[model samples]
Target: MRIYPIETGNFKLDGGAMFGVVPKVIWQRTNPADVNNLIDIAARCLLLEDGNRLILIDSGLGNKQSDKFFGYYYRWGDHTLDGSLAKLGFHRDDITDVFMTHLHFDHCGGSIQWNKDRTGYEPAFKNAAFWTNENHWQWATHPNAREKASFLKENLLPMQESGQLRFIQRGDTSFLEKSELGFDILFVDGHSEKQMIPHIRYKGKTLVFMADLIPTVGHIPLPYVMGYDTRPLLTLAEKELFLNTAVQNEFYLLFEHDAHNELCTLQHTAKGVRLKNTHNFDEIFS
Candidate 1:
């Protein structure tokens, strides 16, 4: 199996929102903000190439939104989903599965795109099955007031319309359930309902995809939960448990939003579990 880092694009978000109640004085040290108090965010997706299946985890924000709609996020950089795929000598049609961690726009927007005629939406990955659990599919489709803005219909409805959407059944257990993708899934509700974090066993190491849960290295601390999380208190407990397991198992965390850091290892510190070392995908795998 081969794993490739697909950088879709970069955008800026309010640092305060990204780091919740964590004081700017603390988070700013790691993810420094610009004059407008916006920090860099990456829509970094992962491509898993196994025998006959080419699975993509998270599609990133596609370029279908209107300028006014995108103005809010302040997107930057020239990286694009198609361009990134081409770099790897692949294309959208090559993807056999799109494993979405959650249905947030930044994560799944690329799942749908405007058709050639500009009449309606279509599945961006024409040949792939879009993956999201039953719980999250309902949560995103019938979104609550707080998360409604993040779960854009344009990014979702088309997949169902195209008849390519598939739901993963969440086991009765709380976390770490076996998935058809040849990895175990760790479900955490604090960020979004049933956000599936894939625990991939690759090359003798377990690599956990850190979706919105622990988005960046700045979010390693237990208290650094995102303000966007529905239940912050629950996040604290979940992070503690996950971090402990990650440390014990020596898992490599793959960050989705972290612009600078791609993968990191955790070490038990006096304060708490902290980043031990950081490396790019090639550096670690090669």
Candidate 2:
């Protein structure tokens, strides 16, 4: 099995919101913010190539939103979903499975795109089966007031309309029974309802796609939770347990929104679990 880091694009978000309760004085030291208090963020996705299946985890924010809608998050850089796929010798239609960690626009927007004449929406990955858990699917479709803005109908709806949407049961180990993507889904609810983090066993290493559980290495501290999380207390508890397990087993955490740091390892420190080392994705694999 081979895994490629698909860097879809970069965007800026309010640093304060990204690092909830944590003071700017603290988080700014790591993820330094500009005068506008906006910090760089990457819409990083992962691609898995195994046998006849090509699975993509999290399709970055597609270029379908209106300019007014995109004015908020300053989407920059030359990277794109199609360009990144081509870098790995593939295309959008080459994808067989799109494993969404959650249905947030940044994570699943690329799942749907404008049709030829730009009249209606269509599945970006024409032949792929979009995988998201039943709980998350419902939360995104019937979003609450706080998260409604992040869940856009244009980024969704089309998957079901195209008859390519598939829902997995939370905590079900059998989700991968029929797939070639040798991975298991780890469910966490603090960020959103049942966000499925993929625990992939590759080349004798356990690499976990750290969805929003620990978005970046700066989020290693249990208290550095995102303000967007519905249940911050639950996030603290879940993160503590997740990091402890990650440190003990030496798992490589793959960041989704971190602008600079990509993969990192944790160690048991006096201040609890802290980042032990950071490396690029190719370092371990190459």
Clashing pairs in 1: none
Q: Which stretches of candidate 1 lie over 4 Å from their true place?
A: 172-182
lDDT of 1 by residue, 250-286 (tens): 9999999999999999999999899999999889876
Q: Per-residue lDDT for 141-238 in model 2, tens only?
A: 99999999999998889998899999888657675566545588788899999988899988888999997888888889989999999999999999
All models: lDDT? Answer: 0.91, 0.90
Indicate the worst ten consecutive residues by lDDT in candidate 1: 172-181
TM-score of each: 0.96, 0.97
Candidate 2 residue pairs in clash (backbone atoms < 3 Å): none
lDDT, candidate 1, residue 51? Answer: 72
Number of clashing residue pairs, candidate 2 = 0
Candidate 1 versus the native: TM-score? 0.96
User: How does candidate 2 fare on TM-score?
Assistant: 0.97
Cα RMSD to the true fold for all candidates: 2.5, 1.2
